[model samples]
Target: MTRACATLTLFLGLPQGTMGFASSFSACRSQASAAPRTALLRAWGRTSSGSSSERQPLRHLRRRRSEGLVASLSTKGEREGNPATEEEAQLLQHLSSPPKSQRRHQQQPQQPRTSTKRGTTRKRLTSTGGLKSLPIVTPSIELLSHASRRSKKVSQDMLIKNARNRSRKWVAERMDMLGKATSKPLRDIIRQYKHQLPILHPFEATLADLTVRAREKTGERTLQSVLDDVNDFRKVALEISKSAAREGKLGEKKSEIMQTMDAGYSRMEDHFLTNGSVLEDLTEIQKSLRSLPIVQLHLPTVVLVGAPNVGKSSIVRAVSTGTPEVNSYPFTTRGMALGHMFHPETNARYQIMDTPGVLSRPDGERNEMEALTLASMQHLPTAVIFVMDLSGHSGHLSSLDNQMQVRHELRRRFPRRPWLDVVSKADLPRLELEKAKEALPEGYLDLSTLDGTGVEELKTRLFEMYEIIERILAPPPEVQR
Candidate 1:
């Protein structure tokens, strides 16, 4: 019986002391007769050592079983030997802890910062002259683009797939969405422009005021009036939305709540459309404002002013960054154009303005283009470069007549301010030049834009005048031992 159990254990690849195999053998002994046991033994012995063909099948079966057991054991051993899982656990723990740099930052003292205004807010930056503050110009497209992005954000963040049909929370959510949709665009436009307008330099503010007042609308509406309308309408729409939501909650109708939301949104859109003229005007104003040159008090400005067809723009193109249209017609420049010139060595930059042609006619005859030039000359700290066409070929105004007109209004008005009288189109005719030279102040330049005559001397003279002004305006140096 012991031998039979051992043989069974050997065949199954178990130790001889294994009770499981012994029990199985005992059970087989009880169930089967002695003849069956003897038959099994005979089968085993024959299978072990017969002909080569007979032994081959049993050998292959045993090898396959041994190989499978070895493969299973090796797989288990590899799994036990691997350190990847342990390393991952350690790495995860390390990441979960706060970094040393963060901890050190937390221990450091934080300084409180104050808001700094762009340019000066006070009336005068220095005692000598009152310079207007510079305001950052915001484009209309910028405001509209911001509004679009904000609306898209609100839609994405507030999506509702399932809501309790007409519950209080759902109704509230709908109202919130409605309010956001209605108020965002309108409020954004008005609020931003309103805020920007107030803090601007007086010159800019006046310009803005003039621009806003110029547009023909249904009713007279200033920037403040537009803002008031938007604010009032917003409040009304939000209230209406809230009332609608309340009614929806009382009755179990999500449709009713949504209808109210739509109504509110429509009202908001209507409010914007009703002020459509204002928006159109504002967009036009933005273009003009963007074109308006930033006036810097510290830097010198050379303004070229003349009647139309007089080469004011040509001289500007020659001397500065401005490229004004030069042609043989009146009012060639519809608006003022600006250019920049930087002095070498000191690297100091200044502005050169090419103003729209101002006719020698009366004030009532002047247009908006002329008004813009007049405003700059009256307000901005600048020197005048009165350009005259030496050629009387255009027949609008003779060189002598043009020079006399400039001297009458501009020169008489700002006598203290430095002036540069330039006769352009020098290549045209010596006849007009000789006639114009009689009325010209000393050092008046004869310049031709096409031939590049007298442009360098003009630039040198401009810079020299700028330096002289800077020297005079510059505060006295402290007395040193």
Candidate 2:
């Protein structure tokens, strides 16, 4: 009985000697019968509100007692020892350990987490290289009218009480449209022209300036001045639009709002019309710029220059890929003609230009066509092939004396250029040819395009001249230590 009392005390985690053996057995039976499983477990120190150290021994004793009780209950019918009662066995099974679900949850492993953030992409802008890549400029008047039409299409679905808000929105939208039309195009043109003008090849730059000067009227706004005026108008228009919108917001009556907006619109229209000619001038300049040739400055160039009807175009057509008109009149090749040739051995490319005929005259007295030839001589890195008509039989107009004077003037102006003289019409009558040879300067190349005489020789010598030019222009070789 005492041993049974001690065993009951260990299972209940109660103080020793607290009950007599008879009392302890009865107490255990009464407690198991009267209290709930959870209450009994709390008394057994499984979840008791005692200090951890005080509860620890009780917990160990309860675990061992429950194991023994379970073993005894499992062998109740087979063993000879006294067995546990049904209530005590049920309490032990429920309170000795955690629930099955919770134990399973604690035994499982957790998974690692991954990030879900996305990366951002950026856009890149491409650049047009130079003036040759400039797009066509839009006409200012058309742009202005288009903007006005777009602004007029704004929605007018506002309440009557929101007249002031509506007016502000309308005015803001209209001002934005006006700026896009007038200021934006002008700004783009100014930016492109300013950027490209300085980088233009010298000959192209001079030709462009001459073209602009020819179209410009006296006492009027120049291209830059017109651009400035348009920009100023943009600022002024913005200020006027803001003031008008503010006035509309302050207006009490609908008529006052309408009047204010109408007045602002009228002022802007009048300002644009005042500078209508400026827009026209800008349009004309765009046309002229687009008309200019796209000259490649990297290649070697050979330029043909002589008086009109002196077989300059004929020689160009015979020697290069050019096919200029072979007319017997003066200034047949009105503009600069460009062609290409290739070196046989090196596979290098060359530019051949046939310019309009230039007469022997002072700079001030020269025409636009002649000015083009002069611009080439003054600007381009080239070899000059001065064609002469000593036979005077191909309807040539310039006298031999005048042609010689022109040659002397060009040589004096550009003394460093490589020059080659060619006397055309070698197939003329024997008497005229002999007379021409007598009058010709030493080292003249006689050629007849009609029968291809000296054509191949001329091409070879031209390539040799270019070789000399290349040698002069090339960078010096590096020296070894």
Candidate 3:
């Protein structure tokens, strides 16, 4: 076919020579004149089929986009040294695909292509977040124990030296010997037991009670009482030793002198233990007390109470100056933990104490840990913070059951105590929003320790509670009598 006829046939998508040659040529010339001109893209010595010419417009449109994309990609690839970036692959895909309408019209079934998500590596979530440490009471249990043991050893050493070097010395020398032997060790024992009264503030005392297992022999004899007994024994021993030395039997009754000192030591040791033997319970109490957080009773206190694994510790760690151990399983916090919240804006400091989980169990059946919770609430002038975990992740009981049981117990037992109910784990999907609301106390808060939801509101409410308490406790303005 002639070039003009061929061009006209291709443009019309018709059979060759369907029209007369002169007519075809005229049609081609008319079409060429009417068609908007485009720059001709040179073929790179590649053979072209008739369909290629038919697809020329689409190819030209894609060519411009492809060239620009590839040039940018080439520069980036040279710098990065990686081939076929995600953007390049996506752009090329769009460029290569036919129009949506055309694809829809096609009858061919497309194979479903699998695509991998980029940057989807799973993140490792820690069971607990780091938190600030509280100014805890550390009595140096190891050092104290070591010193106590060493003092006894030194006293025994002195006794042995006195026995070995029995000088028939004067009354003054013998009295000095007995006094040094008795007083030094007695003083050490007294020092070990005696604590500054101020250090054991009401909260600290309660913490000692909750954390330490003090052995009560006749009912009310405390650590202070034991130390007082030791002090009295020291005075008695000194008197006896001086009297014996003055009577001129100091050297003659060496065994008696040793026995007198031994009796005083035995008395002091017996008060700490049952059989004047190993001070097991007292030692354990000391260890526990030393580890306890030194909570100040002066600040406004808030105590958290809830079922185990109800995010109590999590909230404390997030908002306070304490970092209690947090785990998915229940009862991670076995003892009372202390923390403090300092509000910079209001300049209000609130002491936060997280008590061990209190279960919905019988009073008699309740263990020591649960008893500690009750003791703290009953004794401390605290604003109660009870967390309701609607997520049902809290151990042993359903959210509704926990709320109902805790409410019943608190109302029946501590009706007059002021408390705030907070719903924890608010970031989790809440399937029981209405149910939880109905079950929860009035003015309940939804809080998330993870995302810090409703924390500020909680702090504000706590401050408000403090202010109200302050007003109530404040002496009424002087009556104009």
Which candidate ranks first by lDDT, i.e. highest?
A: 2
Encode model 2's per-residue lDDT on 361-470: one tens digit a residue: 88768766777777665445567888877666534456676777788777665555678988877777533455455556679898999999999999998898777545
Q: For each candidate, what is the lDDT?
A: 0.47, 0.52, 0.44
Mark the regions of model 2 whose C-alpha exceeds 4 Å error after superposition. Answer: 1-136, 145-181, 191-199, 216-243, 266-277, 322-333, 394-397, 429-439, 472-481
Task: Output the lDDT of residue 318, model 2.
Answer: 83
Listed per candidate, the RMSD to the true structure in angstroms reads 39.4, 45.4, 43.6
Give the local distance difference test score of model 1. 0.47
Candidate 1 local lDDT, 1-481, one digit each (tens): 2222222111111111111110111000011011222232232221112111111111111111112101111123322432222322222222232455554443221211111134323221111111122223233233323332333333212344445352445545555655565556656765554344333433443344344334322233333333343355555545545665565555556554444444433333333333323334434434544444445555667778877777776777788844443222111235555677878668787778887777777665665566666655654556688877766764565446755785678766555556788878888866665665567778888888788889889989889767744443343332233
Candidate 3 clash pair list: 136-294
- Pick out the ten consecutive residues of candidate 2 with the lowest summed lDDT: 23-32
Candidate 3 regions exceeding 4 Å error are 1-291, 321-337, 397-399, 431-438, 472-481
How would the candidate models be sorted by TM-score, starting from the highest? 2, 1, 3
RMSD of 3: 43.6
lDDT assessment of candidate 3: 0.44
